[model samples]
Target: MPSAAARPWRARWRIEASPVQVLAALLVLAFLLAFLVVPVGRVFVVAFTGAEGGFTLVHFGDFFRTSLFIESFWNSLYVAAMSVVVASLIAVPLAVILARHRFPGAALITTLGVLPLVMPPFVGAVAMQLVFGRNGTVNLLLMDWFGFRIPLMEGLNGVIFVQALHYFPFILMNLTASLSNIDVAMEEAGQNLGAKGFTLLRTIVLPLALPGYLAGASLVFVKVFDDLATPLLLNVTNMLAPQAYLRVTSVGLGDPMGYVISVILVVVSVIAMAGAALILRGRDFATQQRGGGGLARRPLSPLGKALAWSFVIPVLLLVLAPHVGILLLSLATVWSFSPLPDGFTLAHYATVLRETPQFLTNTLLYCGLAGAIDVVIGVVIAWLVLRTKLPGRKLLDLMAMSALAVPGLVLGIGILRTYFDVKMPDGASLATSWIMLTIVYAVRRLPYALRAATAALQQVHRSLEEAAENLGAGKTTTLTRIVVPLMAGGLAAAFVTSFATAAVELSATLVLATRDVDAPLSYGIYVFMQSAAGRGPGAALGVIAVLTVAVCTYAAHRIAERERSRRMREGRATA
Candidate 1:
């Protein structure tokens, strides 16, 4: 009925998925649907449902009518916005200096800049209070010398200060990488056209790096917006995230206010992500061409060097304050309203190791499983989206990444509401099990692993796979022998990224941890920080958490470097 050309085109339009591809797609879809879509959808349904079980907007209306809810909503918005601004101010100058200039100790500065990320913002809240609180060291000194104290850790200001310091690394890392990729020719062209110094940077360099800046900014905004632990630690419960947590825990799940707050969080997250995308749409900033080099690094003059070091020294000290404070607190016998500790000892570490070693054991078990699940799922999703022609493959990728927009607190609530009634064979509800927490960690961190896997897969060029197939290898065989081996470094990195981040996760764990024995290090730290006697143990636990994350991050970096070096050697041999 059709010509030869038409027949070929029609065949191309039909589904080209292999049986293995189809099966993998279905399994991934089922997992996401069960754990992610269904749970989140359940929250939406409860938020919109009335007392009579009919669809209505009464809960939302009530939310708007309440003055407290209105205040909480605005408070969250203000904090998120101010955090972005402060984080930007800190990150931008640092990123530009590191990316656009060559200076002494540059590598060391870069490493120190990212040290903040190893410690969670919530953990840092405690140390911040110790360093900047009303009765803390800085204030004590200020009263003694300057006769005035700065309210750096007062109320909302404390949350902003801790969040900005801990999260600015996101913007710094992204912007620095983006800036490193820009073509030198663009800057030269601007300079040739009479643009110089600040003018060239503002008009050309900054605009080119905008996509990266926006990416990091949006992440900061979403992270700060849905953060539950930091605000709670600061005793600031007037924000949306804290309110949602309180309403759910204090008022029970059946109370619609928690669901309402969750829905609002999800909406705001989606909007922030969408707004970044909209701003970036239809704008192309690609400047690099084959054989072209990155932006030219300028050497700073003597005065310029002095100015750079002056800025760098203070920022480094500020960023590292939490680590210093926590370490000191852990060893301190008494450290209130003093510029120095009264005494130092190792009793807190000994206490944690002797009494609550299960916290560390539980973290390893939970986050290890979560990291493994993420890498496996991430690889499957990456293969499906990139290699297969299965219908809804892109949709599967989107769904996996959509976890970014779902707040950890919201996900915890959704999982509780959706699965609490579904009993296991052991008679315990699935939502109450430790396995569910593992799944939540996996789901929340899947986006990071997926991106890592996708990048790894992309690096293993199609030609290598094609050559394997041409030599009589089947799809599965080729993947196992050629593709996966090549992607081993990236997969390891992905696992570590997921594992490290999950190790410190507090929002979802706060909701799901039902017992002390079952809880992880994060929950232990939180419990210990609730009283004066426990602050020592809490700070000790915080140090352990930081060490765990730092180790994993270092390992990932080394693995990636080794893989890159191996590839370079292979390329040279081939040439």
Candidate 2:
């Protein structure tokens, strides 16, 4: 439909890729097709196919007819919805306090708010049981004083409590970013129209941040819905993810119910994502413009500050309870039927270090390899999409990002079902091999690395690469010598992000790790926590996992900050 003049202009923009570029793209596509697409497709195929290999809905019918499956489906929906509500309640006030008000220890509070995220929700579930369960420290004190107790960690309530505490940072981070970017002019305009305080916030501030809130809320819903370890750890199996896990593990992989549940999880995730997109359609929430600033932070009055502290301190304590409980548990020699530990020692840590050093080594090896694979694939995909003229480049990006919708448990099931029979030359099935865990980790964490790589590539001006081309540099040379060096910081950060997250990943690890020696720290923690005697070492392992993730997170931040500062300095120098 373009005119002749426009045709040439468009053609000029589309540069033909070199043979090397073509090959790279093909390799990446093959990897995704084999590992990501085929496995998930196999799950759908199996779910729909009857034992006679004919298309049928019997599996789905069986799923619906079963009372337990029905209860699990509803329980998952209820827990996910309630978790969003509770997480929103916790995150919104804190986001407002941090973004809209100036107060002492605000930075510290903000830092502590994100602490829960570094610890996995499953790990925290046990710690929470110690602190808030019926026989827990708080309940013990309550019964002694008032002769009554609250069922905070009983059944589904425990899952919700642990998940809300662990995952609220998603809402907090997104809403805080949204609130900080809101233009102050809107608030002033609302004040001019006789709106004040909560009225102004209700009318202007909250609506402007709805996009971010919805984004976070949808993420929380999907995560809670897809979570496998948390509910299982809490001894609550009447949930979709846990049921899928249980069926696959206990009932054997041949059962169609697991795949059916996986299909439902995939559907719910897709619907939740699509619903959020639908709600946000055609609505522009962009308030900041050039030279504009965020909402002005007002200094808190003494009474206002006191009220804020009273709210924030308790929330922080409650959120941080898992970390505290885990630490005390790791040190406690005997901590039962009491408010505090009877005694403390370092024997548990010593025992973990002496007995299960393989968990640490396996975590390092698997996560390291996965991170490397992610960065390489991410860079290639970013280049093909942004720089080269490749067909279906956007599709490649979409396929990689689609992993976000695939729950780890679902992915694990798919991987097992798809590859359980495919034996390697070593005479072992590919599904049970440790390499499969690494591959799954790479697939699960690809989206983050791809976004990082794309952002990094975008920041490098094309003129620099063009100059290299002008000087007889080929695409390969230019990328290796110029593009990659510039992107080193971002790529390193991407690797760290991938490594840290993959270290704590348990859903796929649960499905793929068939033996004790091949399992990572996450599975080791799960194994240890199943009995009371192993709780000490499990808590110690949990602490180590938390520390590992925290350090990696800090390193990534520092790398990003240093790179940003360098870029700023370069801009100033050029100017």
Candidate 3:
């Protein structure tokens, strides 16, 4: 037998690493497997496994045989592609202006442009419907003024219009992020060499911001392709998501049509991600040098100002018109055969307040849980990859980023597939569980929180972490007391943003929500919009969603301000 001292060293050698650290890693791995891997795996099994224990591709074959399925798939592709193109064109110019100029209303414009980022895509659809639908404000105004009828908003065109309006800001924000890194001196030098306005933009700005445009376009493509609500709401039958939903509910659950659509969606997402990877390589301005980024503003001439406003006004009107319509509808007792409401009433608002309390409560609970999970996972994963010398650091980084490419629908399907039959071995069905929805929301939103946390951690010097460790503070203590508090603003922002989104999420919720459950606010709105009486209730719920996001955004901003103040005070004290 070894001596006691020798036995202690032997025990230490037997361990691969610290039990605490190993346990932590194992916990994370197990969580991923249970929540993500298994759920997605079940989808394939349920789709293919026969009674005789054999596999078949009957589902895929059956799906291809249906013309409706094929038509919808192609329609989805067309609509999404158009959204991608339109978003890129509009966003690129806005990004250029935001990056190059310090205008009077820059902040306001940027905020408005990014408003949709935090809001659900369907909210934009609701807004657009109020403005562009038959008997909508725009059509009503046009009919009254010109005494002529024109079908500007309906079918595929209406879907595309709404999607473009909703997602253009994605392109703008990304392009702005990219252009901020390009040396202004380079553009000034080009101008010095006699390059005029259009030519200068074409040669200099376009080439530099191409990667950002591509990144933004890739994201838009993925979003529009996976989206179900906009197309369904706008009466576009030729779309992928709606077809999938129909196959599951209207056709039959046993039909392979749903699997086929899911497979097609996965393929499309992969292609879009590939395109993003190719176009966005080495073009991240966030990783570039931070200092020396002061853009000199050149005042636009009267003619140039006129041109700018011309571009700005149309989009502003398009964006605001929907909200105006919604506002009018909310106030008016009736909406048809009248330019304005027949009578003003608060009945809709009051009625919604009385009903749907369960939906509101459930939405808050699920979102809050999901947001907390995301913050915890995000911070832990970020700390592991950035602060440690791990074996699969690059792989971890890639996995975290991979969530960006995985659409919400894909993730939802994955969750359903993996956990449909999961239990504690005591006979429990995880398939219809609220816990599953909460987990799905958490992991689906993980990438957003992770990215924000990573950015915040990057801003903090590693030496500070090291300093804390060297001072004899344990890893947990250091992380909790120092790193976490310092990164609180980013963590809080991520949580609140994720919460806002979860509260309004739809397509996946439709698949997962049970009859007894209140479902999310999205489902509630969808149910309301399906009928005439429901429209008033739906609009009221939509307003609630908007208010929810507005509150969360305000909270995030306040947290950021508090953190800033705290940092400044600490800095002065140290000095």
Segments in model 3 whose C-alpha atoms lie over 4 Å from true places: 1-16, 44-58, 280-295, 393-397, 421-429, 459-472, 561-575
The TM-score values for the models, in the order shown, are 0.96, 0.97, 0.89
Model 3, residue 162: C-alpha shift (Å): 1.0
Tens digits of lDDT, candidate 1, 1-575: 79998998998788888888888899999999999999999999999999999999999999999999999999999999999999999999999999989989999989999999999888999998999899888899999999999998999999999999999998999999889889999999999999999999999999999999999999999999999999999999999999999999999989999999999999999999999999999999999654768888989999999999899999999988999999999999999879989999999999999999999999999999999999999999998888877888999999999999999999999999998898889888888688899999999999999999999999888999999999999988887899888899999999999999999999999988888888999999999999999999999999999999999999999988998998899999989
Per-model RMSD to reference: 2.3, 2.8, 4.1
The candidate with the higher TM-score, 1 or 2, is: 2
- Ordered by lDDT, highest first, the candidates read 2, 1, 3
**Model 3 over residues 292-318: C-alpha lDDT tens digits?**
753445666777667666776676676
Candidate 1 overall Cα lDDT vs. reference? 0.93
lDDT of each: 0.93, 0.94, 0.73
Q: Which 10 successive residues of model 3 have the least lDDT summed?
A: 285-294
* Candidate 1 Cα deviation (angstroms), residue 120: 0.9
**TM-score ranking from best candidate downward:** 2, 1, 3
Which one wins on TM-score?
Answer: 2
Which residues of candidate 2, in runs, are more than 4 Å off? Answer: 1-15, 288-290
* Candidate 1: residue pairs that collide: none
